[model samples]
Target chain A: MGDFDFSIIAANWRFLAEGLRYTVQVTLTAMVGGILLGTLLALMRLASLWPLRWLAAAYINFFRSVPLVQVILAVYLILPLLLQFLTGRLIPIGADNSAYFTFTIFEAAYYAEIIRSGIQSIPRGQVAAGYALGFTYSQTMRLVVLPQAFRNMLPVLLTQTIVLFQDVSLVYAIGATDFFGAADKITQRDLRPVEMYTTVAVVYFVLCFALSRLVKYLQSRIAIIR
Target chain B: MNYHWDWLFFFQEADDGLMYYQWVLSGLGWTVAVSLTSLAIALLLGSAFGVLRTTPNRWLIAIGDTYVDVFRNIPLIVQLFLWFFVLPELVPRDIGLWMKQDLPYFVTAVIGLGLFTGARIAEQVKAGINSLSRGQRFAGLALGFTEWQTYRYVRLPMAYRIVLPALTSEAMNVYKNSAVTYSVGILELYFQYKQIIEKTSQVLEITIVITLAYFVVAFATNRLFAWIEQRSRVPGMIAGGQGGK
Candidate 1:
């Protein structure tokens, strides 16, 4: 520890910030994509035909069962090969653009189940009341039930977002030069693995701690009795 | 056909792809080993945290809160990298060098999974404990049970029953996250698939194998947990109307 130089991090602040921007972009894109996909699956799982419900279940189970690393790896590595075999030419790729796509697809699986549980937590009576008022099932879900379900889900949803923020680091596995990747590169180049990695870890720790605190604050403000 | 699906290529010794499938089996073994070890570690720490959260002590509650918050927010892979690569570098020079040379991959994988999944199990366990009535605790006290005894007998069983589903999900998550071990070169299932895909360009076949492996493991594990949940139901809870078939 005493032998480690702390000043390298100060020197690399701009590079770190660039990495942070990419991390933030990936996190935001994946979260939004995950929520939309999640909501659709939630609705399908609830009142859709048996086949649709099974399909929804299978999607969640498959995604959640496999490791996110596997999912990310498959998208970046294996999918291209499979596609190249079908098509005449291989897909051209840019690092960040391809990375964002992989992250969204990877995160969508868990988020779908989270949303489904949130919807399931809603009372059956409320849906029946909406129907009694002559609202179609979709209309009732959209107008009344989903809003309440979202409220019920807000705390867990926030927690999931924080998880997503953390998961953005995994993009480094596929060559995206995100914050963690930058730190790893620094470690490799400078032979100061401890200093570089610790600097990044502290940065990650501060961000995650702040996010969890924010979630708690939000939960208190919008406390649901149930 | 420009792209013939040579399924027979996989079964022949002349084809250089058989080694990749063997790697997948080894990777699967590592995944299972890491999952089981981490599950044990997570359960122990989580149960202690669960007890603390329900205790009358304020500081203990704060400690549990801090633990869960810190670990839950960070990505598991970052944690793994920090544990395997960085932590060793920061320790005493002699000890650090020794660790870098000697630390087992399985040990690192378990620590990674345990720390991440423990935070989740702690939340589930605390929720389980809170769902029980105040009267149950009082009843244990009235029956002359010690604090530890009360926990061992009255509190934990019901709490386990209450949080069975959540624990099952966490178990699955830990199993899935174990694949992150590949980045540190743990050679888990995904690692095997990557090697296979790279070697023979049988990307679809190997990808399908990994997917099927996960599905089979998950389904069997879920069924096992469901059976445990059924068996662990409180006497009247299942025999009476509350339990679903």
Candidate 2:
């Protein structure tokens, strides 16, 4: 029943900016950490050692099966206790840190699957060519396979990143003051839930839509012609 | 800091005369109900829009693209809040009043979750349809069938079978995404987990149990869909590879 007010948002621009900063910070951190760990996991799953493959598969399956909210809650609550038990001292793994770690760990499973497919898409003859030219397993993966895989899967990776950006909002469950959370706090304070939520929704839609279009463009550009 | 673990705490009855496990069961019921209902909506709407996107008509494709872009980009929690709070105010006054007064939280959650997920499904359905060879469509048309009948009998069945793996993942995603409905105050499993944690302060045990419950649901859904994918798969049709978690 209340009229929309842009002035409320204008007055609180600083708070919203801080929230956006934190959201971007967590997203970038998670993206880097997730890709590193996920690539390792994908390599492990494709490893010659059965135990290594089993361990990697189990980790991916367990994480993939559970909801991200559960992972966020568990990490937020349990990581501190785990640290305390292990070291007999309580470390302050704050909500934002917990959110970052959880996103990294949870998203790795998804990225692992994507990266695995990318790696597989490379012809076996290429790997054999690497070995045939006197390369170790690690050297072959690094020098040839991984670079090509990254190129092949760039679109999927960026698509997942867009999904990750949307998921960053879920950090609100733990009160991390991401963009959505910042808007939510304003709503609570201003008693203008409709305007605040509508603004936040529009912001999210624009960001995600733009990112998806970029992904599409990348997909078309880097599309490896068979 | 010296908290003792109470593995049996879930078995203990609360003052309300129900055990915590019972609360979880009821929460699971709501979760399943919400997920399945939303999935039904997603399939119907998603397929419609997906098929529309594949048509040669420009306007229909624009409508499909707009639907997917609008629904898929916004986060589900935001959508849920919008449905629960802003939507009623935006509609006609009488209907708005009825929505605010008579519409249940479950209905709101379903609409929010369904439409949001329906967008994702629309993308998958479109991809599945596009993956089919043009020969399949021509073959259907050449068989003296109308376009609608050709789609229903020939193209759709094959498309659904091809996309079964992606559909499986979407089914599991719907169940997981249902957790977001807790934002709108639906007493689903995640909501119940928060409630129990607040009252009991047994965060670790409760969270572990909730995680396992979600895992079981997702795992079962995965297995069920994998089975369907196996049965319905065409012998050598691109292997029906799984994608999109």
Candidate 3:
């Protein structure tokens, strides 16, 4: 107990902060990109066309079924190779960038499900009213449905984003310098596993716990009137 | 495509005289062991804590809530890392060295995985119990059954039945999260992924094979849980007594 020295964390705060910045950056990128692609996937899955529905279902199922760590590694290794095979050139998407792509696509599967549920939660009459107004299908979704769905599902979406934030740590498998990975590196270099990992755990707990509390509050406040 | 595809690489010998497929199988065994053992821990702990949260006692509820918050909010990998590396340092010198040098990595991974998943299962259990109508609790109390007995008989069984579907998903997640144990260098399937890839330099094939392996396990878990859910279902209960799907 006496050996507890947080000076290690204090000395390396900047390095740790850089890692924290990368983690947040990836979370935001994946959040925006995943939600975009996820909305597309959700629409496809909800479409009348069987082929589009099937394709979206397959993508969601395949990604959701695998571990995030494996996909991080797979994308880190396989994505570039597949690209080179098709394009005849090796595009250098580094491990860090690879984490971005993997999380975006992988998380899109989950976000798609959330979005699909959100869309489902909106009554059929709302869509019908849009159609009754002589609005086109795309127009109804873009103008009437999506905005409402986004608001109604905001709490759930934020909860998932909190999950995504924690998941950013899985990039450690592919050697990305995320917050957890930064702590890991410092631990290795300084041989102070106690201080480094403890600090990381405390930071993660405070952030996630506070965020989840916010989600709980929002769920009560912004819940749609049924 | 400049890649060489060797479908027969699994049959090749490694340095330890085991075929490459044997190594993969060994890793798979560890993965299964880690997940199944952790599931046992999770179910027991989750049920206990789950009941704790729903109990009338404020003290018990506090303990359960604290457990859920601490374990669930922290990423599993961090928990695993702490349990694996920093735990020993925090303990007394002799025992710490023993833990560092003597404790099996498999046990460490399972403890971390179990506690983390247990917190999640507790939440599910709490929800399941909460979803039940208030009349049932009142009826149990009117029957002169003590609070513990009432829970032991009436609430828990129905709660388990009600939340079997959610439990199934958590069970499947145990398999997925087991991959994180690889970071601690346990000889699990993910660890072997690095091994086979490094040894044979066959990235694409091995990656596909491992991914398929994970998918199969997860899919099977889903099906098994579906079967269980249907079998133990009570008529006119949640989901209108329909299939869990």
Candidate 4:
């Protein structure tokens, strides 16, 4: 209790910052890729055809129910093997590069639901009005419905992104050095569990807390826009 | 790497006197234990904090809001690591020793998962309470109920009904999130998967089995919650005006 050292964090702040860079990278990749893929899936779930609906539902349900750590592990092991079989050699996405696509694929399920709700929130008459104005199906979705849905879904999407950012820490299971994993490595080498874990926790708390506040603010502003 | 499927590996015995299938079951048993115990804690704390958030007093609401914000914002993996590693060091000397040496990993995982999930449930419960019409509160007051009494009787019951639908997802999340405990060294399903993979060539098979195990638990949870939701339907009330869900 007497000699808590703040100097370890200061000494290794650059290393930790590098890890934070990777964390933010994975998060942004997942966010952008997930939203695009999720929007497509959401449309499939709402498609008039039964097979599209079932396929989307099945994909969404399986991902939603499984533990993300397991998914990460699955990616670590199986993805390389899959690429090997597919391309005649392991294309070597390895644990680190794999984390990017792994998260994007997994998070698409959650984003699908959010995007589905967002798409649903748009009035049917808006789509009908688009069609009436000589718009095709994709045109209405691209021009009128999706933009409005994106705005309506912004806060929820951001909230889930906050969650995805927290989840990016789980790549530690595969020995990838995201922010949390970076702290873990430092803790291992320095034998400073207290300093390392506490710093990591504090950083996460601050980042997530700030994002949540932004969500609240945006939520109010978005609500007023309608 | 050439892949071969060996489904029969599940029937083989490990040195611990349990077969692979039984080991899988034991893993499942632990997963269920973690999920249920944490869920119990989450509901108790969640309801408390949620009610506090909805209270007319600013202090109470702030207290609840702070709790939710602190817990929810941090990842479960970090919280588990903190409770398992840092907390034991932070406590008083003797208690810290006990935590380090004597305390069970399972208990630590449960506490970590519980507090984390409780924060989420508190948000759900707060939303449930706030979504109620002002008339419900007025009716409780009109019935001569005090603030606490009103919450205990009128507001809570209907509020819980409204939130039941949402709680199903939370219930599933608790189970899914229990997998995070593997980082803290609990012998849950994922831990079992690691153990089995080390001993077998059926990595894909066992992975599939683990995925199925989770799917099965989730399926059962969904069915159970659906049954409860149906049975608890207030008949022209639960859907907030429409017929039963």
Residue A49's lDDT within candidate 1 is 92
lDDT of 3 by residue, B142-221 (tens): 99988888888888888888888789889999999999999887799999998898899889888888988888888888
True contacts kept of each: 0.71, 0.71, 0.83, 0.83
Score each candidate by Cα lDDT: 0.78, 0.88, 0.91, 0.91
DockQ scores of the candidates? 0.60, 0.61, 0.84, 0.79
Instruction: List the candidates' TM-scores in order.
Output: 0.90, 0.95, 0.98, 0.97
lDDT string, candidate 3, A97-192, tens digits: 999899999999999999999998888998999999999999999999999899899999999999999999999888889999999999889899
Model 1 quality (TM-score): 0.90
- The residue pairs found clashing in candidate 1 are none
lDDT of 2 by residue, A53-98 (tens): 9999999988887778767877898889888988999899989889
lDDT of 2 by residue, B180-228 (tens): 8888889999989988988788987888788888888887888888877
Instruction: Name the 10 consecutive residues with the lowest summed lDDT in model 3 chain A.
Output: A217-226
Name model 2 segments beyond 4 Å from true: A224-226, B230-245
TM-score of B-chain for each predicted structure, in order: 0.91, 0.94, 0.96, 0.95
The sequence of per-residue lDDT tens digits that candidate 4 reaches over residues B1-245 is 58988898788889887899998999999999999999999999999999999999999999999999999988889899889888878889899999989999988889899999999899999999999999999999999999999999998888887888688889999989998898888889998987888888577999999999999998898888778777777767736443233
lDDT by residue for model 1 (A101-171), tens = 87777677777777788888888899999999999988999987999889888888878887888887877
Best-to-worst order by DockQ is 3, 4, 2, 1
